[model samples]
Target: MPTLVLLRHGRSTANTSGVLAGWSPGVDLDDHGRKQASAVAERLRPVPLAAIVTSPLDRCQQTLAPVWADRDLPPVVDERFGECRYGDWTGRKINDLVKEPLWKVVQQHPSAAVFPGPEGEGLAATQARAVAAVREWDARVLESHGKDAVWLACSHGDVIKAILADAYGMHLDLFQRIVVDPCSVSIVRYSETRPFVVRVNDIGGDLTGLLPPPKSAGNKDEVDASDAVVGGGAGTV
Candidate 1:
């Protein structure tokens, strides 16, 4: 088993402008986003990450840039971690999209929601693929590394929310109720039986405890209670 850290990319121009930058190219982290990325990097600096997986998007890659800049490990780009394909709504503003008839379904019943375009992707399908990708990565990391291995996945808000929903065993319709903010960190430790959700939507806090103590040192069996800190937040899509 391994600890998977889900990190959403920092605030982007689209987030500030209230636009839906779904799978849209050229979307990058804003100035404030750069600072947030730096903060997240520093927060996890002490943790020994086995690998870093990132969505194949500019914003995600840009957000991960600072973290990987000083490390020898490069990111593994996975398209499954990319943003929900909004189809015709790809570059549209969220304000205008809210007026659409399917907006209610998107917010209230995302499992039934479908992007209105020929190439659009369904919310359920998005959740399945994203969850599968995370599970695959988790298994691969554990097999290659060890039970206490730690890794990071940089993705979009919706994608991270979908993965969180799967980890919580929640139905897809209830996924919209999970809010993953910009540059937030959510931790999940997979075990032989089930996954333990250590933290969710953690923006800023003491993360030193998340680092695994030296294996070659004494008291390797001792568990840090602070590592299991739990908190909650209101949900938003």
Candidate 2:
């Protein structure tokens, strides 16, 4: 069995600002996010990693930068691991959108919701795409590197949870229960026999004998024009 780890990027500028950062363009990680990724890297330093995969977003790469720097590793950027596309809702303040009727419904019923904009991917589509991406990546790793290689992936919060749900046979409503904080870690075991969850939503440096064991982890949207074309991306380690 190969150990597959999915890590959410560390905190970003938009995360601290309380804004919705869908597929925007330039947002990057904050200081705390960097620290989180650094901590995760330290934790995995001893494990020989077969590959470190990430979303093609600055924040995601930035979060894992410290880890890669320390371990002398490089990550393979994959578009499939990107965050959910919120279309028109990208780059706007969360408070501003929360008041909109459609936004409220989407937040309350994300599984069935859709953003009002062009090029926006629905929750179903987002979930399906993320699941497919992970599966492909997992298959490739196992085939090329053998079954027991340690695989790591850094991705967005939504995509991480969606991937978990699909792999573990959980429902989308349970998505609200899983939280992958910036720089948090989630582990899954992939084998020719089956795929299993090892942990979910674990913050790096939190396992200092003070944190609880990994459990069924418990724990997003849209756009803007004049939006300054704010950028968005994914994170992982």
Candidate 3:
């Protein structure tokens, strides 16, 4: 069995502005996001991760930088984990697009929703692609390092949510319920059996019981969940 840790990138300016920044170049993490990433890295230091993977997107890469550097591990960038191709909606205000009739379909039925306009990739398409990518990563890591290997993936909220829903038995509708806060980490263990979530929406990195003791030698049990918030988005990628 391998334990997979999915890390959502820290908050970006696009997130605060309510814009669809799919593949947009300027969607980097803000100062607060950088601090959050550092906190998460400190909390995750105890986990015996065999590899750290990330979407090639700048935000994802930035979020993983501190943790990756601390562990002296380089992140394996995978294009498959990149965000949904919003096409024409890229760099547009989320509120503006939701007002459109066609975009409403996504709000009501994300599993079947398709992006309108040129070269857009649908929810179903992203689901299929990301799932395959995760499976491939799991297979390769497990084959090379065996079941005890722990893997971390730095990705977007929707991407992590969708992958978790597919791998575990979580309802697609409850996708909105899983709060992936900026710099938050979710852990899942996978074997011949289905995956099980060890923790969800954990912020400030309290991995006490879940992680083996680290050389830093500090022990703590209390974790504050105040940083998490309800999903305001009508639909996810």
Candidate 4:
């Protein structure tokens, strides 16, 4: 299947304010975040993405603005990729939430955590929908663009973390240990057998590695992109 590049949106005004800002409307990227967004364009210049998907929230859209500029790939907005519905916790300060008893449950056992109020979504539910979204997209991209195709999806921290957990087969309770920083990029490639997590929570690194290697004169000698290289054999050419 095609390679999947997971990007967490850049820092937002809520981040500086120490607020949760879940599903908040006006949370655009802060100055530092805008810079990070611009840098993403340069880092990804050498790679050609088959598709770009994004959460409908403003911050995730803003984070991809530079990457989409002067390009034909307008981002496809997917609601399932949106931030976890925090319900009453939306726009609340993180400092205050940490003091709440539920915060410990969220950190120590997210699988058992459920936000308060009718609008609130359970952590387990978030994981289910998000994992399904990526898996669906991966299949679509692979069929439309071929095995070597690379793709990008810009989303929130928790959403990306949940997707990564599914790829790694890790329980939701252990997901808190994974840190997806602002504007960071993670990679995953799905094969017929299983999903391979190539990288995770990468803030900055060489992205040329994302590009598929050149094809040989004959297809007979081609190696399967989905196959893991034993002894971490020579990386992408």
lDDT of 3: 0.78
lDDT of 4 by residue, 40-130 (tens): 8778878898999999999999999999896789999999999999988998999899999999999999998889888899999999999
The alpha-carbon RMSD values of the candidates against the true structure, listed in the order shown, are 5.0, 13.0, 8.9, 1.4
Q: Of 3 and 4, which scores higher on TM-score?
A: 4
Which candidate leads in TM-score? 4
State the lDDT of candidate 1 residue by residue for 1-237, as single tens digits.
689999999999999999999988889899999999999999988888999999999999999998988899899999999888988989998889989998999999999999989879998989988999998999999889877789999998888888888888898889877888999999988877667787899999877766774556576755442243246332211
Q: Once superposed on the true structure, which residue ranges of model 1 sit more than 4 Å away at CA?
A: 213-237
Off by over 4 Å in 2: 70-72, 205-237
**What's the C-alpha lDDT at position 79 in model 2?**
87
TM-score for each of the candidates: 0.90, 0.81, 0.84, 0.95
Every candidate's lDDT: 0.88, 0.75, 0.78, 0.90
Residues 1-237, candidate 2: write the lDDT tens digits: 566788888889999999888778899887887777777878866667778999998889888787778565689888888888888888888889888887755655768877778967887778888878777887888788866667788889888988887767777756766777788888877655456676788764433221222334442133221122246323123
The most accurate candidate by lDDT is: 4
> For every model in order, what is the number of clashing pairs?
0, 19, 0, 0
**Native-to-model Cα distance after best TM-score fit, residue 26 in candidate 2, in Å:** 1.8
